[model samples]
Target: MRRYGIQPVASITDDLDIAPLLITSVGRLLWRYRSELAPVTMLALLIGTGTILHSSYRLWWPTVAGITALVAGVLLYAGRWVNLTRPIERAYAATATAFAGGWLTTSTAHGPFTKPLPLVLAIGCVVLAAPWWAHRRRRARVRVERTLAAWPDIAQAAGLAGSRVQSAIVDLWGYRFRLGLGLGQTVEDAVAAVPRLESALGSTRGGVRVQPVASKKANRADVRVIETDPHANAITWPGPSITFITQPAKLGLFEDGAPVRVPLLRRHGLFGGVSGAGKSGGVNVLLGELTACPDVILWGIDLKRGMELQPWASCIDRLATTPQEAEALLRDAVIVLDGRADDLAQRGKRVWDPSPARPALVIIIDEYAELASEAPQAIDHADSIARRGRAVAVQLVAATQRPSKDAMGKSAVRSQMDIRVCFRVREARDADLILGQGMVKTGWHAHKLDAPGKFLISSPDHDIPRRARTYLLDDHGVHTTTERHSTHRPSLDAVSVQALERAAEMPITEDAPPPSREAEKVLMAALRQAPAEGVRINDLMRATRMRRTWVYQRLQDLARTQQAEQVSRGFWRATPEKHAQ
Candidate 1:
């Protein structure tokens, strides 16, 4: 034998061990291709069993078939016990098991080499094996096996030499493995070596992510290998998902296609993003659901001259267009809040429970930075509400382009936000501004969001950084929702109305100005110029220079005399004769 790079063997004993060497070489070859030999090995085992049964126990074929059916049934329904998560994969496994068992039963009744039995076995094996070979999970499993086989070398090269893969799960998006660090190693070391690990494991540049396992020991990590993109398209809205004001509103779908249900009942939320980053669309979805609730009273402050909130003005109880109106509206809300608190105290209740008679107040503020700049005083009231309103079911949902300390009027507004959504931002630090400080460094990479609707939510229920996309509610949707729900919109409860009356120092009237000659002429002018959609209570208050109680009282008297009409809830306009008069 020719040995190119070795010294010549001169000893006869060293060269004479051919038999043992041949056996050892064959053993190594079999070990190397063991997975590929699995099917053939199983086939051989089946053939041996068939021969034994046919030769000595052919009468047991019926029992074999019964056992086969039972096994197939167990495998089909309880396949999760064996790690089959997908229904299709479980079905396939059951089918294969049935085919093999039935073929073995028939073969046992005849012989392993029986002509038709052999043919059926051959055809069935190939047919069943086709799916096994083509299955994604099976392929992924094989890949995982190969990777684990080379893990020692990979770990050594990636500066994680002492770590070992404990277990792995192949998912729809990718695969995740639980890794056990060495005695002195920590999960931080593994996280720090993520880039090198990805390279060593032959994954894409940004494919690997290492998360510490939630355990007291700092020696375990969950290493995920992302092989697929989850946020490839915009998930369409599935309509209003909430009926009552107490349930969480369905925002959109997360990367895993699960619904993103966010609780809006008593929580304050802040939506921050760049211009045209689907912030308005997300808020519209919230409005669509909130409008459908009968136990919620909707209020809005749109400082962009009501451009964003006007579409749903018919449903909103109060809509603020400019700075002065916004200030007045917030002040009134605070009055209502204080009133509810006193009522709760008098009733021996710790918190106000909302019902149709006592609806929760949700204020949707669009472009909150404008409110901060134009009506800085309103921010104080907002801060008060944020700090104390949750228990009483008074919530604020603010959307802003920039929610910095200065942009938010250098108040506790940002800090008071319990639920925050950070959309696509220009800088990494901007994520910290929206989601709170140090969020960017902790892997809340909102700046990496590629799409407009994509965002990361930080709330009590959702603390983990999972990418989610908001359902887009366009202008048509807004108009449709407002029209459908405007009639059912709940008016502010008596407690809030009474509070407003005390603030105005007059008895509130739903229908006649509390005898104000100066306010009557201004109310008439506003009624004449009111748009087809009519004007909201705040607009009428602005026009009439009167409190909402006086406006309602005067409007009631005008409607009674056929001089004015209510176009929608909380919206009134003058009749043709009244306008001319």
Candidate 2:
């Protein structure tokens, strides 16, 4: 009897040890596949809830149905509040809720164990769970969660141990996280570890980006993992983004699929990249947007005999194809700038408010390096426009293969460009020439951009470095767009036109003042005797024995006082009554 008892007790003790091991194994599996098992767990919960309600509150099925309907309706109509932004996600949520509630309501009335009810619940759960398990975004979210959960190990493998993920978000392209660094760690440290991080996370080369947080926190960095490349192809132009110059122009798209809208109303922009880097494509996209604006008069200087800008000549108010023409265009732009500044001063306004009758001037210079070297005299005027053009809505958009000090000229033009776009540069230091000093070290890695049209923009709206791609406007696109927008193009404002006319009439000598005696009398007499076509500004300068500046200023004053008027650009005439006087 003792031998038999000892054998049975030993077998029971072995079984007890195996039971604990089995429970531990199951718990590990449930934790390992928590995201994947969510739907199964939810179904189990629903079954238990239905059974409990059927036992105690069978009569409350109608209330449960009504509440379920209300909740499903909210989920269908307003699921964005719950972070369900996609239409399919909202629909799935609503359908899942309806299925769960309908099962609960029926089970509460008929009992959860009733013959086909259990079978029906199982079928419905499978049907709904299929979509939940197959959802791409959901899978991505789960993957991001698991990766973040393992970030400590990943960071350690990448020589960045103790770095913690503060917050994370998953989007269509990829995921981004705010990382809190350990003591003595910096964003540069994280940037330098990008390759290691990509390897640690099993990502492809150049798949991870480390940027400094917008808050400028010393110990924080924004890390982006590019699971899907958004700028893999050239984005086609979607036509003009704005009809007025005041609104921001949609230049391209960011990696997160957001529009790269930068306001060009009163800002100078610089575009720098190597040849064949799609700098021209970016310029074309910008012109497509700016040309559509009725309150912007477009002027272009393409020193390569208009090779780059000739396609949009129908829309550009002035297209300079020669070095002489380029120099003249920039000189006239400065004259217009001075004229608008004076007008704003007289009106007691701090800025020029552009309108159809008073349009803003946007000068686009393609191959700016050529202009700098070929027409060096124009750099001073370009510098002046860059310095003071913003207030009066005179903007300069300069595009160059390389914006070196020698290529951009020794001027403030590069420094004053508030919106800087660096495309696929040949060297890292070239980014600093285009984007500003110390930009390369700060993670503005324009040199790493591999594809044409891929760029990094730095502006008041976009201070952080994010990869973006410019819209493609091929030759056909440029032709169609220019033809569509040419009819809507506004002529230069009277102030700018008159200023250009005076500049055209100026003598070779610079800043020469008018004769002190009989200048006003001679100008009035010339206007009275002027042909019906009206007197040219050159003729007026000759008649008054005055400088072009003096003649233009007096004419503007007389026209304002209703004593004189412009017959055409650079042409003026006196009123009939004033001539009689």
Model 1 whole-model lDDT (C-alpha atoms) = 0.83
lDDT of 2 by residue, 492-523 (tens): 68887676666645565644453554778888
* Model number with the top lDDT: 2
The total of clashing pairs for model 2 equals 0
Task: Report the CA-based lDDT of candidate 2 relative to the real structure.
Answer: 0.87
C-alpha TM-score for every candidate = 0.85, 0.84
Clash pairs of candidate 2? none
lDDT of 1 at 97: 80
